[model samples]
Target chain A: MVVQNSKSNILIVEDEKGLRLGTQRLLEEEGYAVSAAENGNEGIKLGTSKEFDIAVIDLRMPDIDGLEVLKEIKNVYPNTVCFIATAFASYETAIQATRIGAYGYIPKPFTPEEFIYQIEQGIKQRELILSAERLKKEREENLFELASEKSRLNAIIKSINEGVLVLNKNGELAYYNYAALKYLNIREINIGENVIDKLPSKIVAVVKTIFSNDTFLLKTYTVQIEIKPNNELILEAACTPVPHPDGSLAGVVVTLGNITEFKKIEVIKSQFVSMVAHEMKTPLAAVQGFLNIIVDDTINVEKEKRKDYLKRSIVRLKSLTDLVNDLLDISRMELRTKHREIENIKVKDILSNVLQMLELEIKKKNITVQKNIEEKLPAIQADQNDITRIISNLLSNAIKYNKENGSIGIKLGSSPNYLILQISDTGIGMKPEERSKLFSEFYRIKNDRTRGISGTGLGLSIVKRIVESYHGKIEVDSQFEVGTTFTINLPINLN
Target chain B: MALIAIIDDDIDILDASSLVLKSKGHDIVTATNTTDGYKIVKERKPNLIILDVMMEEPDDGFYLAQKFRKDGIKIPILMYTSVSKAIGMEFDKSEIVPVDDFVEKPISPEELVEKVENLLHLKEVK
Candidate 1:
């Protein structure tokens, strides 16, 4: 085992040479490393520099007094223990030295045993003080580390993209990050504001439900809200409760995110599927009907008679092929793989061509057609093929679903910024529900069956998509069994 | 003789339709696509046009029907399609398929002749 050094380094400062020498000799014999100082000034200098465990100074010195020296040593080396050893020791002097941080005092004529005892007591007191100082330093370091960690957490909460809010136990806003402020369209800082009073009714209700329970727990609620001064902007937000450290009720922490775009995309996809199915069915049915005519031998009478059945079957078969091609076009457009050829085109020419194409069906139905395209209509810059497809689709649907001998009309005009095209037909109009989903892929009106009209249902969907890609808009007005009018607004100049 | 113009994209359908209409003791003109069908309609001026919804293109027949209306061509049209009855939708009396009548595909020979005769009578009455 290693032995601990009990001996301490002591400095004896006294003006009298004989007493100082005697005291130093006694301390050295007691296993202490002792140093000697002749005056108070020298004692103070030596005491400050050397790592002395204790100092023994005389009450009266030539340069500086013992109490003054004691004050200086205590101030400089607070941990170092001091003892007063003076020949002129009195009750008043001893009290003064002790008050100035002296550890112990011994009269000049004291015996060696008494002197050793006082020095031992001084060393013990110093050990206790040093241990206490080390503990306090460790506690201070821990407190600094905790404060830094809290600041880091606060910074992270503020930087997150999602809105974050913290409310106190009384449902008052305690903390709200920048994202939360923006999401709510709150211009001013709202800390300490009551959440129930400040937030909209829907959100306030959700919070109230979450915090109704006594025990602090994590709970989530969703609510719809309008942000900004504009009520048009809709947002879906989620609120959750945060618990306190003691497991008691703390404030609530809420996180909110926006999800408006997701809902619109889902509606478009469903409509596309239905239109494809409906369009394909019509041609397939015709093919089947023609096949039945050819197979039935009873119907055949002469060469000319037999030829009729074969000819009808062939017409239906060609229609099937056309339907397939149309489906392919739609697929390409949906994937955005097809690039449109843009050019300047005359609106009247396109409208006239479309009308000429439908002449046979119109005449057969005895439907009257009218055109109101102005002669001075300006040329529109657009993808000619896409515009043709758009106009053709609308006109076709109008005629295909119109009353026999009904009127079909077309109007074209141009304003400063836009080219307006309108097509109206005395066809079976659509209900509100049908109108809402008219632009959706594959959505057909419920009443088309009775009229025996056939469509792919992708017409309006394709038209809408093409118009949007060109940064234009389309609108429809229709009433059940009355008529339908489609209005297309296109930019005059392509940007 | 009663003249019927058959417009469809499929050569097979053109052949089959011609055979059916001819067998029914009616004169038939067939066009394999909407462009040719329109030409045939303008020249032949058939009493009735047998239009298919999908021909050379999905909406080709429908477009042809609208064109005829805009050009003031007044002829009775008979629209034939397979999916007409599948979706439970009916054509209104005044709509584009606003033909004298509509016939779903795979029709029997007897029904085809009967519908044709009835439409002819309806035309005479008007």
Candidate 2:
């Protein structure tokens, strides 16, 4: 990696043949790699290309003057030390040569020893300058490496989800990551300042737990703390000891992970499990009870009565099956529902299909259905099956809950970016408080009238999930004992 | 025959529970939600009320119970909790949830009858 040669090379530029040969031999004898140049031009050429450590030039030459040669050599290879020799004593030339970075001047009638000593001095000066250049280059490379390392470290700190705080051996703040600043709500921080006073009280306690003892050799210690007065946030702080290059304790790195979202998901999952278990058990219990009553020999069992019990068990089992299916749909939607197949579909076509499917129920309920769809409703890009499910659920609920001979109104139109669908039903409406929980999983209105209505209770939740998957909005407007209306706006295009 | 009010969010559960109670030769008054449940208790004043803990709201049963106490209704309340106790959330008789007792959902008919009988007997004594 170092540009070094075994013997230092020297270039001699003298018009006098005898002087040039004599100097070259003397330099060779002194263990130097020597190259002779007859004129100033040749000297300049050899000085740059040969990697010569020093150039000895005569002030007077046939082609180019020694001063001009010195300037050329310095312009090309500024590190090559140069010396000027002249027979005439000229003060002007000496000053000019010195300015061009000449090592020194050699008098024309100099002894061989004096010339050798002057050449040696030039060689020494060249070695000193080259060493200094190498040192400067090394310093610059080191600075670059440090900058790149700092940025890389900063990038790693910014990307991690955990909040990090690093403290030096003196219990001062050495470094804190982006997450640390956000979690601790720190605006500005000074390097090497005491951290305990700066950090929030909750975080300070955890950091103190680690820094209390130098003999605490544990690689990692964790504790849970809560932040309050604004938002209740649970943070898990894990502190790890950083060791110095000599294996002594240097600092501690604490990482804080916000686990509030994870905690919320855990609670929801547990509740879902409990609800599913309770629902399934309800049906199974009913079936078991009916079977037990059917096999009772102590009671006079009529065939028709036994048949009715079996029919009721079948209905309960059917409801249980529907609940299981809805659960499956939910799980499937949770996993990769975003990757559903998209196709352009006419809104009216889907609505007509749903109405046809629910024809028998409408007729049985004696409900008067009215439709007011815009003639040219814009097509939407959606999963066709999901759209069908959304329409079917809304229509089914309308008919099922409507009073006998009640009127149902349906409207479909479009705005600039959304296709709007509204369904109004003169049904058993709900209070304002009940509307909020209407879309929650397995949420069904409970009262004397609705108790006789057979439903899986997951239908509206399914409708909501599907609509949200398409990035659509659903709203409900209801009046107690008056009527209920549902408005859905599906986006005309997916973002 | 003693009049009993059955209140629940799930229609099937209400139907099954009401059937079980009616089969025991007691008259059954049913309300699917808290609003109707409160109305029935005020109008008919059933001998006892069987309330579901989780209706449309997680604390619907507690709210109804508080309301009943505010109205000075001394009728015994049997709360049906579909939530398993294994989950470690407990809500017993309190000022907030003023109920006589709790019955786990998916109840065996015999357990339902026994709890209802005990609650009614305790109410009569009071």
Candidate 3:
């Protein structure tokens, strides 16, 4: 009968010549390729260099004991299956052998079939472990590829115009894109910095509150901050928290968008609407008042009364015309339709002309006017009409808002670099809020109505535009109900 | 007898002012435009002048006032304009409207008489 051949390679490590030779011959007869080692020292060397299907060793050996040799073999070749054969048959030895990575331990005097069966089982176990390891390695490679692809996509998202930022669990900036850097004017050093250290005090407080509360999700917050170099940056920011798989807090992501221009346009729109209402209301009130007086039969129907009503109606009509003119002036200025016809103009002459034009209203009020114009004041190079209008508006505002027996003072002087004109009035002065909006188009002090004052509310705005065109500066100082002063500084000569 | 000349682009204002001065028993002459007003002032040489700020042109009255001062016309000119006196700014003792006196539009006949009488009285004392 022909013997079946086994493809398992087995190593017998025994110090006793009789036992070592006996096991090697038995394994070879059972169709296993067998190698024999005289002691643990040789066993260790063979186990390291050669890949054995199963390693069977005697428990008691001389020079580097069986347990020590078994440990060495597993350390070098973790996939090699190991078994211990011992005549002592002690429970402690069996346990010790298994603990040190042995497949199984058999007592001496065991049958040859039993030894073959243990060796075959160890070899099959080793093959299963090696295949499982290869499958694990392939899965890890695929995971790394997916992670790299995600990183590339995130890099593209960071380059967009909208600002994006991520903060770590410590409230420190983990990542910020280029757009966020530009919007916040953040320097390279600021990256990975603590959020509280980089933000303003107000903003830091809000962020700290959000960070401390795990349940709160601050989706949107609008804040205005002065960025580096002192530019007003308005941002509409949204914040969301990133959570770990176990429902613990991980980090926060914030996106900020600039809204400075949007705010400016909104303010302009509101001011325009209020201006239109005031303009229409003034004329309507005047017209209505005069008509009521005429309709009242109780007041004598005398020639004087009739003439007074007619004169007032005319005045109202003129006021309406002036309002329309002011609207046209602003539109022209915005469109850049008006061309400046620059010419040499005498400063004193222009002041005198403005004064003369308003002389009637001035004298009627019994207001004292003092003029301190220098005789040798240099002629200014400007658009004569623009200058005249600017002076006229300033002067008119003063007298219109003055009290009975009030006084106005005008001073004209020249410094080395500029010609200055200062006009002061003892009238219903402006409050801080009023003064702030004084030069804005269609902005008028609320109390000005009590004085029966009529203005297009575009006078100061026009003055500011014209002054800026000439590269001049206009400063205003006023105390509420006390007095108001406007100081204009213009270039001495434009040659 | 004090002679007063009134120059205004608006006929109604010119006529109304003349009526006020005439009622006060002062001799009055009226001109409707800058040219006629200037000629009348140079020829008649009134004791006082009442000028309107807004003539056919907005600064027509201002130009006339300047021309009168340049030509050595020393008659105390009182500028009467439709522009409100409450709107005229005051600078020191001299108000923005450069004149001996000023009266706003829809002028009360009583106020008109009172200002003219006082100005004439001031002239007499001077």
Worst 10 residues of 1 chain A by lDDT: A446-455
Stretches of model 3 off by over 4 angstroms after superposition: A1-260, A285-311, A404-406, A428-437, A446-450, A479-482, B1-126
- Considering only chain B, report the TM-score of each candidate against the true chain B: 0.84, 0.93, 0.85
Instruction: Return the lDDT, model 2, position A420.
Output: 97
lDDT value for candidate 2?
Answer: 0.83
TM-score of each: 0.51, 0.70, 0.38
True contacts kept of each: 0.45, 0.18, 0.00
Candidate closest to the true structure, highest TM-score: 2
Which DockQ-derived CAPRI band holds candidate 2? acceptable
Rank the models by DockQ, top first: 2, 1, 3
Model 2 lDDT tens row, A109-179: 88889998997788778878988999999999999999999999899987898898898866798888788
DockQ of 3: 0.02
Q: B1-126 in candidate 2: lDDT tens per residue?
A: 689999886655665666667777788889878888899999998999999887666678888999999989989999988654655657778897899988886676778888998888887787
Q: Is candidate 2 or candidate 3 better by lDDT?
A: 2
- Model 1 DockQ class: incorrect
**Which model is ahead, 1 or 3, in terms of DockQ?**
1
- The DockQ values of the predictions, listed in order, are 0.19, 0.30, 0.02
